[model samples]
Structures are given as C-alpha cells and as structure tokens.
Target: MNLSDYLLAQDGHDWPSLLSDWAEVLPGDFIVWIVNRLGDLVVVLPDGSVHWLDVGNGSLKRVADNREHFVSAIDEGDNANEWLAIPLVDACVASGMALGAGQCYGFKVPPMLGGAYEVSNLEPTSLAVHYGLLGQIHRQTKDLPDGTQIKFVLSP
Candidate 1:
C-alpha cells in the first residue's frame, strides 16, 4: 500500500478523545493525521513539530521539526519501513482484511502480551478499541517481569 493510504482525516479533535487513554503520555496537545499498521499515530505537536505516538508501547517521540520534514523522514528508507509498514500493510490487504474510515489494523495480541509482529496477529479494529485496550493493558503490565504470570481481566 502507498504511504498516502495511511493518512487519516486531519481532524484532531476526534483522535485525542478516541485514543485518550493511550494519549495521556503525549507531550501535550497535538493533531493526528496518520496511523501506522499497528495503530500508532503521527501527530503534529503544538510547536509545529511532528511526533510519533507508539500506542502499542505507550511512548511518544518527535519525528520531525514540521510536516515537511515528517514527509521526507517517512519516505527515507528505514523510517519508511518502520513508520509506513508497507510490507505489513500489503500482507494485511492481501489477506482480505479491510478497515473502516475510523479504524486501523490492530494487534490481536498486543506486544505487551508478547504478540509477534506478523500479519497473523493483525485485525481490522476501531481506533478507540485498539488504543483503549492497549493503554489499559500496558499501564497494568508495564512493571511486570518478562515471564511474570498475570491475568488480564477487562471490566465495566
């Protein structure tokens, strides 16, 4: 899939709230314009800098000074592979997967639970569900040891 295929609507208002649980760790206010295969966000920060919100791991970091730099950075070899995840996207597409406008490809077993970075672990999911679940799960398990056995229970 082409990189442009990943660009979500630029309306920032909806994203922050949809992913609010995962976005609490962000460096302040921002707008989400893109999402990677694992449902990570590419956001333009208040200072005109672009940052990556690794929702799966609940981490954020600046990717470029601005949108222009962000475009170049995303197309530049390694960053392209990591940020765009074309290969994975293509695999998902070929496997008969489809996502709605408000959805993305999300991990069936998130990395925090030892999910492998493979197409077999992906599914089309609403952004709210992906980030909300990951945010809660990661927060609960962030301090646990690698092999620590713990039960993950979701409650209303």
Candidate 2:
C-alpha cells in the first residue's frame, strides 16, 4: 500500500481507530502514544519527537509565527469539540521508522472534571505552565525538527 492509502484510512476524531490504522499503515520503528487530560492523542517518534492530534471540543486556529503557521485548538465557550490535525505528522513518523530508529513511550495526563463555573483548587494557568515546561524539556532533550517541538504545546 502507498502513503496515500494510509492517509485515507485515518479518521480525524476517532483516536483508537486512527491509532490502529496508523500502526497498520505505517508500522514505524517507534511510536510513543499518549492520551492527555483533554482526550487529545499524542504520538512521539524515536527521534524524541511529539505530535498532537486534537480530538477535543475546542476551537482550531492557525497562529502565524516567523512566517510559519502553527495550528492551535483551544477549548472555549460553546464550541468545545473543535479538532486540529498536525500537518504531515504521519509522514514524519514513517520517515523516522524507515531510518531504523526505535524508542517509544506513552503517557496520559489525568482528566480534570468540573462545571464551567466551578473553580478548582489547582490553577489552570499554573497547570499550563507546568505542561509548557515539560514540553520544553522534551524538545531540548530530543532532536526533532524545530517546528515539531512547538507542536506539543498545542496538543491536549
């Protein structure tokens, strides 16, 4: 089967189905999969890489920085199910696999539950900062394309 065939088999919001399809389609050397607090699916490659598949109810927007487009899906009022796709993410994973790299890790952030008006003891801002720090650490330690590093932040 060709790359197009693999891409065609994937569904945008179904995480498990998508993952299974990805594994069959690409069968890369390494696949580090993660299910975050917000139900977002993250896949990291052998080269210490990460990619976020937005499967949450959020608003997807393209942020322009340094002449490049960075896609972000933000969970906001009313429209909480918006989704975003990491462009060429699958290709990157397939390429890494073809290169014979092998190292995969999967992690999941615990879910946060509450009504819109309820304020939790944990500050959302602080949590964001903590995740941001973790993303930075991953990037510095892993050798991936520059644009790929920022992709983690936009993930769930």
Candidate 3:
C-alpha cells in the first residue's frame, strides 16, 4: 500500500462537517488538512501548529510547529508510518479489506474497551458513524479507572 491507499483528503471532502463530532475533545479551532484510512486526522490549529488526531484513542498530539515543519515531520523517521497507520492498513489490504468513499477502518471493539489493535478486529465503517459514536463513548469513559467494567452494547 502507498500514500494514495491511506489518503482521505480527496476532492470535495467536507472535512468541517465530517470532523464536527470531535469538537468536544479536540484542542481549540483547527481545520482538518489530511486524514488517513483509519479516519485519523492531521489538523492545523489556528496558532500554526499541526496536530495528529488519533481516531481510536481520541487523543491529539502536536506533530510540528508549522505547516512547513509539519511536512518534514511527517516524512521523518517512522512518523509517517505510525501516524498513517500504515502497517495496519497494509494488513487490511492484504486481507482483502477495502475502504469505500466516506468509509474508514475502524475497530469493531475499540482498544479502550479492551480490544486488540490487530487487523482482524478492523472493518470498513462509515467515518461519521464511527466518530460520532466513539467520540461519545470516549468522552464518557475518559476518566474511568483502567480496570473499570464497561457494559458495551451494540445494536442495529
């Protein structure tokens, strides 16, 4: 798999609408500049810093001080691989999983809910649904003790 395989910054993407679900947890104002197959985002904050929004964990990390630096940071060392979820994306493709338009790779059972990060637990899901549900779940569970029991339920 290559950059094209992981890119979610396609033509006509309405990122503001797509990223609205994350407002409760995100740091300040920003624009979703890029996204990977996992729905993880690379956003630019108003202060000119670039940050990575880790979709699964609902966490954010500053990757660079500015857009120019962000470009270098992304290509430096293993930053690209980890930030883009390249290994898992590769595995999913190898396993015949393909992400369609408006879809992303999401954990069937999220890691915060005790699920492994293995590709076997990944599936193609609507990015909006995944982010909306997981954002609420993460917000609710963010302060719970590590071993706390979470009665997870799923329904169609």
Candidate 4:
C-alpha cells in the first residue's frame, strides 16, 4: 500500500516505514497502518474497516466501518491540531473516492457514548449514523457515561 501524496505530507514517514512500525506491534494483524494519535494506534483491517489499538489497555477499538467513512469523518473533523484529517482524506482519495467541497458525505454519531467495541461484532447501521451519514438519532442518554465518545463512520 502506498501513502497518498496528501498523507505523505501529513506524517513525513512513508508507507513502508509505517507498515514496518505496525508489523513490529505484538500480534500484528493490520492490513494498512494509518497513524498513531498519541498512543492510540490506528490501523485498517483487510475488510477496509479502521481500528485503533489502545496501547494502554492492549485492545483494538473500531474507529470506522470502512475507509470511506473514516476519510469523511476525519476530513470534516477538527484538524487544526489533529493531523488525521489529511491522512484520512488521502486514504479515501487513494481508494478512488471522489471527495471535494460538495462530494463528501457525512454521517450522524453513533448511540454509544464512548469507549471501544469488538470489531467483529459491531452494528453497521449504528456506525453509519454515528458518523453523521444517516438521519438524526436520539439516544436519550440516561446515565453518565465514561470516557469520550468514539467517532465511528462507514456502513458496516
């Protein structure tokens, strides 16, 4: 896999180096390595879904259902300090998705507040909604949840 031109500038490191670093991780099983926000390791699965390896807990968290949604969410998200926007956009463009001013699509945030979930057992529709793609969703949060909200995109 090659890093998009836009992505190459975002992180300086090339695809080979990134892949090498990801392979060094224990129990390596990532198809495509994205970026590491702080200690959170972001990777892409064989099916094109995005996941984050929580180094602190030694767990993998679903970030997006697929690359498309991942790109859109990151591109539209706060990128001033978060350098993930360009990389995400590059990933999508590299995948051959035509994204620009009015081409990109957005999704609604998922119902689950925050925290990570099993990548294998995820609700695709919920993920789409969470990314702001589907119509508005109301969860009526009953209790005070823990941790920040996880932003998952893509349709399952």
Minimum summed lDDT over a 10-residue window in model 4 is located at 127-136
Candidate 2 — which residues are off by over 4 angstroms? 1-18, 23-27, 55-156
TM-score of each: 0.84, 0.22, 0.90, 0.31
How much is the lDDT of residue 126 in candidate 3? 86
Worst lDDT 10-window in candidate 1: 6-15
Output the lDDT of residue 39, model 3. Answer: 82
Clashes of each: 0, 4, 0, 12
Candidate 2's TM-score: 0.22
lDDT of 2 by residue, 1-156 (tens): 222321222223343433442342222643434333222444544554444443221111222221112122223332222222222223334444221111111123311111121112112222233333334343343454434423234756
Give candidate 1 misplaced runs (Cα > 4 Å). Answer: 10-13, 145-147, 153-156
Which lDDT tens digits does candidate 4 get at residues 90-111? 4444555543321222222222
> Higher-TM-score candidate among 2 and 4?
4
Name the lDDT value of residue 154 in candidate 2: 70
* lDDT for predicted candidate 4 compared with the true structure: 0.40
TM-score, ranked from best to worst? 3, 1, 4, 2
Candidate maximizing TM-score? 3
Error of 4 at 54 (Å): 1.8
- Candidate 2 positional error at 52, Å: 1.2
lDDT of candidate 3 over 1-156, digit per residue (tens): 467777775467666666677777786578777888888888888999998988788788888999999888878999989888888888898999988878889888887787777898999998878888777778889899889998756697
What lDDT score belongs to each candidate, Candidate 1 first?
A: 0.76, 0.30, 0.82, 0.40
